[model samples]
Target chain A: MTASDDFAWEPLDDVDDLEVGDRRELSLASGKLVLVMRTETGLHASCADCPHQDTPLAEGMLDGSVLTCPLHFWQWDVTTGEPLGVAELPLEIFELKQEDGRWWIGMRR
Target chain B: MIEVTVEDRAGGRTRFAARPGERLLHAGLAAGLGLPYECATGTCGSCRATVTEGDVGSLWADAPGRRVCRRPGEILMCQSAAAGGALSLKLPTAFRDRREPECRSLSGRLSSFRRFTAEIGTFSVELDEPVEHLPGQFALISAPGVEGPRAYSMTGNPSTEPRLDFLARLSGPGKLTPRLFSNALEGREVEVFGPLGRAALRPEDDRPFVAIAGGSGVAGMLSIVEAALARGHFDRHPSRLVFGLRSMEGSYLLDRLSEFVRLSGGLFRTTVAFSDEAPDPEFEAIFPDLEFTTGYVHDVVRSGLSSISADRPICFVAGPPPMVDATMRMLVVEGKVSPAEIRFDRFG
Candidate 1:
C-alpha cells in the first residue's frame, strides 16, 4: 500500500500475538509450514519440523535464543539456524523484516 | 559370525565383525565407533540407518522407535542385528571415533529385592563381570520373556559395589515392571547393556546443582546425590533436590534422602512435593530434614529456581514423559536456564 514497495515481501499474519520466547507454526501460501519465534533479539523463522525426526518445532521450547525439540531435545540457535549439541543438521531459517510497522518473512538473502 | 559394513554421510566407511545375536548399535559402539544414540533400548530412534545391501534381523518387532523410520530402508540400529553373512548399511550422520566403549553387554542375575511401597521396590543385579559406571547413568535391562529392554536408572553407587541397584515402580501396564515385583524373579538371569547416558555427576565440577524428578525417576537423582555426597561436593557447593510423588503412601527412599541431608550437614536440601495430597502430621514428624510441599513438581522446581546460586548449576531431571517435558519447559522458558545446562535421558 505504499510507494516503492516493489520487493516481493510476503506479509505475515498472526504475528501480533508473537511474544518473546514464543513460537507458532504458520501455514504459507506455498503449503509449506514455517515456525516463527520471537526471541529477545526479535523475530525468527525456520523450518517447522526438525531435521532429525521431523518433529514439529512449533511444539518445542525456545529458551532465549535456542530452540529445543521436545522429542529428542536436539537444540539449535533459532536466530542463525546453527545446530547445537547433539543436533546434526542445521535448520533452514527465513529472514524476517519489520518495516513500515508491518512484519514480513521471505527467503534468506 | 557376521560381517557388517557401515557408511556414513561424511564419506566415512568402517567394517566390523558382529557376533551372532549382537545388536548392530551395540556392536558398533563396543568397537569404539561414535554412533549417535539416546535411549538405546529401541526408543528415541537416534540410531536410525538405512540398509543398502543385506537385511538385518529385528530383535523387538514392535519397537516404538520404528515410528521414526520413514525412508524405504531405514531401521533402528539398536533393534537390528546381522541376520546372516554380510550386511551393508548407511547412516545419515558422520561417525566420531572414540576410545572407550560407550556400552558393553553384562550378563546379570537378580540378587535381592526390597519393597518400598505397594508398587515401588528396589532390586539388585549382580553382573557376571564388574563394570565401572558414572553416577546418573542408566541401564537397558531385558528380563526373560520380556519382549525388549526397559531403561532404569541405577540407584546404587557402582564405585563402591560391583552390583547394580534399580528403583522400580510398577506403573499400570508395563512390559517388564510386573516381573520385577515377583518373587520368582530372584536368581533370574537377564541381559543388561549399560553404563550409558551423559547426564553424569561430575564431582570435580564443584558447582551448585539441582535435581527434579517424578515417580521412579528419582532413581538417577539418588545416584547423583549419593555420588556428590561421597566426594564431599556438598561441603563446597549448595545443592537442591525435589522428588515428586502422588501421596504419602507412594513415597519411599526418605530414609536415604534423610541420611544424605544429615551427612551434608544442611548443605544439600531436599523437598518432597506431593501432587495428590499433603503430608499428614505423622508423616511430617518422621523426616525432619525433608521439606514437604503440596503442588505439581514443576511448580515446586520453579519456586526454587530463582533462589539457586547464579554460578551456573547443572540441572538434572527425569520422570514420565509428560512430567519431564513440562519441567524442562519451565526451566528453559520461565527459569531462564540454558538448554545446555539441563541434562536428562529422554527414554522417549
Candidate 2:
C-alpha cells in the first residue's frame, strides 16, 4: 500500500457539530488546511483557499452544494471542487471518511 | 409575427421562432446556437450580420455597425429582431475567441457613496470576498430593489483587494442611481457581475500615449494608468491625458488622477477641459501642474494631437457615443492617424 493509503483513519470532529448549509474552519495536525462543510447530503472537505484568487473559500456564500467566492463571485462544486459556469479555476478537494461516529479527512502527506 | 430564416455561414437554412418584440441576438443565444457576440446588447457591434432575404426592423436603426454594412441588406442582429415572416440571415463561419476574463456574480455591501457632481457619484463596494479582475474591466451591478443590471467600470486598482470603486453618472432618468441619490443606506447588500471589458492598456514601442476621457469615461483610463505606473511606462514613454466635462463640478476623479501625475514624475501630464463652464480657479490651484482648457474634450484632444503630430502618438478615447464618435472622426480624418491605431470604447 502507498504511504497515503497506510495512514489509519484519524477522527477530526463530530459530524453533529456542523449543521447543514454551514462551514467550519480547522487546521489539521499535518499542518495542511481544510474547510469542512455540511451539505444537504452529508459532509465534504476541500482546500481553504479558492483556486482562482487565493482567498479563503469559507468566506463565500453557500447555496446548497455550490460555494460562490465573495471576491469576484467565482463559484465551485464544493463536493468535487469542480468549477461551475464561467469559473476558470477548479477547487482542491479531499476525501472524507466516517469512523466511530466521527468525521475525518484524508490527507496526501 | 415575423418569420425570420436563420442561416449559418455555410448557407444552411434553419427556421428560428422570432418575435417582433424580441431582439435577434436574444433569440439566437436562447436557441443554443453559437453566435459571435460581446456586450450582447447593442454597443459592441459584434453581433452584426448581413440580411440575405426579407424585410427586418431595427430598433436602433442608426447603429454604428451600419458603417461596416456595405450592402443595403446588412443589419445589426442585436438591435433588430424580425418584423415579418420568412427572414434569412448569415453569420461568419469561424470565430476567434476574444477570451475576455471570466465573470461571476458577487455580493457586496455598499461601504460608502459620495456625490462628486450634480450628475455623478463615486461609490465603493466592500465585498466579503475579493473578486479578481484585470485592469480596465467593468462590472454589472444590480442595486438592491432595482429590477435590471447596470454596467459600471471598475475604477479601483486591480492590485487592491476587499473593495472595488465605481463612478456612476446620473444620466437622464434611471432606476438605481436616482434611488441612490435619494440616500441608499450603507451596508446594504448589492449584487455585482463583472470584471467585463476589453479596453486593456498595452504599450508598444516608445511612442507617447494619448488618453481622452469625458465624465465617467475615466474608469478605463484609471485602470490603464495603474497598469502604466506598475510597468513604469511613464518613465519610458511620455503620456498625455485629456479629460472633458460639462462643467467644473463634473470633474470628480481629479484627486485620484493627481496622484497618478505625482507617480509619473513629470513623465505624465493631464489636461482638464470644461465645456459648459469656464475653467474653475480652485481646480487650477489644486491641479497646478495640469493644463486647463475651455472647450469640448474632443476638440481639445484634436488641438493637442495636432500640435504633437510630430511625436507620432497612439490615441485612446472613452466616453459617451457622441464624444467617442466625434473624437474618432477627428483622429482618423483630421489628425490623419490610421484607423488601426486609434481605439475607443463608448460607455453608453
Candidate 3:
C-alpha cells in the first residue's frame, strides 16, 4: 500500500536484526534523521536529536517506552514522542512499518 | 541599548533590555527573567534560542554550544550579544515558574591563597557584601585584566560572612590562573557575578546524597558536604563522596575528607580514586578513615553501585566532560537512576 504523499517509505533495517528494546540511529539521503526503537508492541521512530540541547536520542537510556537524553536527563516517550519529566518539547515522530520482514522509515515524499 | 524580546513556547513573552557587549543570558537573568541556562559559559546548549528577528553577534563564535544549533537562526544566549537595535528570540520550552535567586554584580578582594597541589591552588575572596547561594552554586569571577569571566564553584558553605572560597587547577601561566596563583593577588579587587547554576543540595531533602568529583571539580562537592553537614543530613541519610585524581602526588583535600568522615561518625563515607597509582603505605596511614581505590571515578562508582540505595538518592557529579558523561551514563543506563536525580554543570 502506498503511504500518504507527505511521506515516502524508505528502508531502514531488517526486522530480524533489531531485537526488542533496541534503538538505532538512521539518517536519510535528504539529511533527515530518525531514531528507531523496537519494542514488544511494534517499531517506533522519532527525530534522532533530542528536543533539549540536541543530544543524540540514540545515546539516550530507553526504559520501556521512555527515552532519557544523556546530556541533561530530559526524557521522551518513544511510542508517542511525548515529552516526559524535565523535557518540555515532544520529539518529532515519524511513521514506520514492516514490509517483507524489513523495517522502513517514512520520509517526506 | 538593545530591546530583547524572548518568547517562550507557551506563547508568553518577556521583554528585557540588553546592554551593549553584555551576554543575552546575563541581561535576562539580571532582569529577573527565569531564562534557562546552565554553565553560563559557551558549553551546555541549555541557553540556546532561535532568533526570529534582528541580528545577533557572538563573543565566542566557536562555542561548543554552536554545534547543537540545528537551524539557521539559532544562537547560544550565553555567548550571543545583540548586534542590532531590536531582537526577538523564541525558546523551545516555557520558562520554569520556580523563582530564581536574584543575580547581581559585586566586587570582592582576594583574601587568601594557597597551593593545594603543584598545579592546583585554593583561593578565598571577601566580597564587599555577603551573597546568598545554595550548596553547589558557583560564581563568575573576572580578574582585573582578564578578558572574560571564568566560572568557579564555591568550596565552602554559604554563611553570613562575606568570604567565599574556590579551588582551581592551573592550566599554566594563562589568562586568569597566573593572576589567581600570584602572591600579589591578595587584596586585589575583582568582579564577581552570580550565585548561578541549578545543581544544589537543599536543606529539606531527606534522600541520601552521592557526589562524584574529578580534580578541581571537588570544589562544589566540598560545599555540598559542608551544607549537608550543617543541616545534619548525614546523620539520617548515608552519603557517599567519590573523588578522582591522577595520583597521590597531585591529590589534595585528603585531610579535609578525613575530617568530614570523622565528623559524620561513619555515616558519610568517602573514596579517593587514583587513576594512575595505588595508595602508598604512608598515604594509607595518613588517611586511615578515607577509602582508597584505583580506577576512574566513574569506574569506582560503578563497582559500588550496588551499595547505593536506588530509592531516589540525589547524585551530584562534577568533573571534566568525559568523567561527568561516563558517570551520568552509568547512573542512568546501568544503575537505573532517573536522569532528574543526577545534577551537574558543563563548561567549555
Question: Relative to the true structure, how large is the alpha-carbon lDDT of every model?
Answer: 0.82, 0.71, 0.83
Model 3, runs deviating above 4 Å: A1-6, A13-16, A107-109, B172-174, B307-309
Interface RMSD of 2: 18.6
Model 2 chain B: lowest-lDDT 10 consecutive positions: B92-101
Q: Extract clashing residue pairs from model 1.
A: none
DockQ of each: 0.37, 0.01, 0.61
Q: Write the residue-wise lDDT of candidate 3 on A54-93 in tens digits.
A: 7888887887788888777887778888887677888888
Model 1 / residue B103 / CA error / Å: 1.9
Off by over 4 Å in 2: A1-109, B1-96, B203-207, B280-283, B306-310
lDDT per residue as tens, model 3, B162-236: 888988778732477777777767788998888898778875678898899988888899999988888899888
TM-score of candidate 1 versus the correct structure, residues matched by position = 0.87
lDDT of 2 by residue, A3-107 (tens): 547554445764467888898767787776788888998888888876543557787666678776543345678888997744556778777777676777786
Docking class of 2: incorrect
Using DockQ as the measure, name the better of candidate 1 and candidate 2. 1
Please report the candidate that would top DockQ against the real structure: 3
Task: Give per-residue lDDT, candidate 1, residue B94.
Answer: 77
Instruction: Please report the candidate that would top TM-score against the real structure.
Output: 3
In what order do the candidates fall by DockQ, top score first? Answer: 3, 1, 2
